[model samples]
Target: MSLTAGGPRRDDFFKVPGKGAGAPVKPGEKAPVDRTAALSVGAFQPVVAAVPMPQRLFEHERERAAARAAGEDATRQLKNVGADVDVALTTAVLLLRGVEHPKARERVVGAVPQLAEAADYRPLDAAADFLGLDHEDAAEILEELTEHGVAGPIAEAAVRVEELRAQVQQADHEQLDELLEFLLPVSALISIAGAAAPLGALTEGDPHLAEAAKAGVVGLAAVALQELHSTEHPNVELESTELLEALTPPVR
Candidate 1:
């Protein structure tokens, strides 16, 4: 089900009090003031307070801290992996260039250097490109060199590069997951607030009714959001899918 099915319109949320739909003014009669509309905005504030806004704010801060820590760790790991990738690519390129094997020399001559430069900032891409170049009859040539005790040290550099590339990809995915985890609760709260707005609008005039309504709406919104969070709601899935598509690398 749509999370925001009956929520206020984007413009309605920002509309001035006493300016919404009201009884029309007759030709010479002054426009009647809408006390209900005027009171709606003030009434909604209590509803917002009824929800644990302060608690949610605290939780949001904690999530942000966690996300920041995850991001820093990912950055550190990627930096080390990038250095390793550069070293591995350089070793593989140099060794393949020196090899007398016609196919290996033909493949690594000038292409590897350009690919390396093209993906200079993108370590994962660089590793994949280098591995791709090395996989085509090139590994066999490197094995032959190893059998002859030639270029034996650099022969396994491609394998090391592949392992390093996997680490980079894993680090990136972990960072994305952390970001998504932080965002999920934020989205749920926004949905809850929107759903609660209309219910709060109904209790404008009576102070006691307003208080009771605020409590009821807050409880209802909390329950609804909890259920939506636990279930595989289509709206939640759509948001997650969009975020993944936007943040994930094309190479993966």
Candidate 2:
């Protein structure tokens, strides 16, 4: 497939007007007229006013605001989920620590550090190394605990943590979709304005139009940057599944 070419280079419009070497004017010479200002005063303002701002731009702003609020809510929910997971894991580990079976108790107690590391978002492989317990070992340990009839609470807690983890992932995906909905239209508008800059300069001989096009590009860039700064990435990897599995007892 053919690749699309890139947009105009930065030098096309961002050049300094009088910085390069040029002949020095005599002291008596008249200053050159600022044609951009002249064009704006003469004819550009009326044409600009005739084309009112599109209603969709307003809609994009509203959607972006809503998405931002939703993302904040999601963040709050994630923190609360983490807190709940901490509590549940703590309770389960405490229960396991009291079990009389030597092998099961040793395995569960040994996994405490790994469980804590996972909860804190450490890499799964790194955390798993603490007890040398892969998922299969975890499953065997869980089965042994179930045979002793002490795994009920741990299993229930793991189920709850898993459910909460699913919710976090879903929220992240939804927030990303909302953010994309806002960005795509704004990006399209910037591309349109950028394309118009050269046409305004070369075809219409209107410095005012060119300036407006440049201003449009700059303004949209600011808007996009502000939104990005204010908003979190939609797919923030919580690494929560690792945490869930770290403490999770196998299903019957």
Candidate 3:
């Protein structure tokens, strides 16, 4: 009766037979695929990581900014220490010149406590007048302090410090570490007279004079610290920070 002998129409070319979208395929034949189905206009989004692209970009920018800020801060601090160190070097040289004094006789000890012990050192007010020199007078003062035998290890240490500073100027990392290992002893190097007497200012009446003397010793020590810690002012070998850290005891 009907012209077609079927359940559903299949006149359209490539249309599925017997069933619509879910039709089964005959043996040795491929199933129909719906190429015309609605598709998303943009990129296909598979499951992605938690932190997305925009946030990752922002994080990278933020970290970069922080690093730059830190570098600028370090540079400023280095310059400031350079000035402080210049005064300290002159004070130290002046103290060296007066090494024959009765009150002076301590060198090379753990920086935090050893050098500051007044019982171990004599007064250095004789060098006080030198502290007023220009902030950049370290070279001239170094020349003065380089007197052999009298300055002892202090002079030797200072020479090595300058060499290290040159390495720092060149930003030399390759050889810096080796030099640092050698300089560890430099930091501890101090020249002391054979025997130091007890506090000589007992009858001087002026306690401040003794205090002033302590200031010079401390100043010299401070210069040493600065030489090893400066990260800017275009200063010393081994980045100083790394060297100083190496001196610290490791965490258990």
Candidate 4:
């Protein structure tokens, strides 16, 4: 029997430039247009000169606006992270996306002080930052995701992940799929089960350590969550019935 090797790529080592990466955009590439600029342009009214404008122009503008909105939303979520925890958080996400970078790995494994710090790291934003996937990439992938399967459960799972993030304890084996599904593009949730589907292998054993040779969503995120839960950011004694219900493995 033959098997495929799933792993990081050469490009995974390079940091993807976000909105203000201070680098020029390549030809044919979309410039980092801010959300406001994209939206304002969308409301543009061309002066009529006794000629009907092409519909394609409006379609192009709409697409650009959408891309900016998605990108902006992702950026907003990441901006809230404190500098202290950003690298570790992002690195864990890189594992989830299967794009491990040396820099991220170094920080994730390096210091005890670094791991002990806690914050309200929003799961969706962390997922977006980790992948560094462009808005158009998300938009394009979303179409393919929707055409092939039902995505409602996957998106709902993303919400459930937020609840998981709020927990002060490590997640158990049963919540494995929910952990990964939260990272997938909503429209594609049921399609590939997330690009980092290999994370499923880490769902057993201690449910706490759930080790993997290659740090994955469950394994890497577990490290970060265990640290965050160490201090109990929201409340040490908080209880979440809804989160528990959402993670309950469905009866087959």
Candidate lDDT values, in order: 0.30, 0.30, 0.28, 0.25
Q: Each model's number of backbone clashes? A: 0, 0, 3, 0
User: Candidate 2 overall Cα lDDT vs. reference?
Assistant: 0.30
Residue runs of model 2 more than 4 Å from their true location after superposition = 1-176, 196-200, 228-252
Residue pairs whose backbone atoms clash in candidate 1: none
Candidate 3, residues 195-222: lDDT per residue as tens digits?
0101113242333333233333334433
Worst 10 residues of 1 by lDDT: 1-10
When summed lDDT is taken over every stretch of 10 residues in candidate 3, the lowest stretch is 190-199
What would the per-residue lDDT of candidate 1 be over residues 50-124, giving only the tens digit for each residue?
443223333443443454566654454334333332232222222222333454334433333332243322222
Candidate 4 lDDT over 30-113, as tens digits, reads: 553222222222121121111111122223323433545566443322222211122222222222333133333443343212
Better of 1 and 4 by TM-score: 1
lDDT of 4 at 175: 28
Q: What is the lDDT of residue 222 in candidate 4?
A: 37
At residue 202, candidate 4 shows an lDDT of 30
Cα lDDT of model 3 overall?
A: 0.28
Q: Candidate 1, overall lDDT? A: 0.30
Q: On lDDT, who's better, 2 or 4?
A: 2
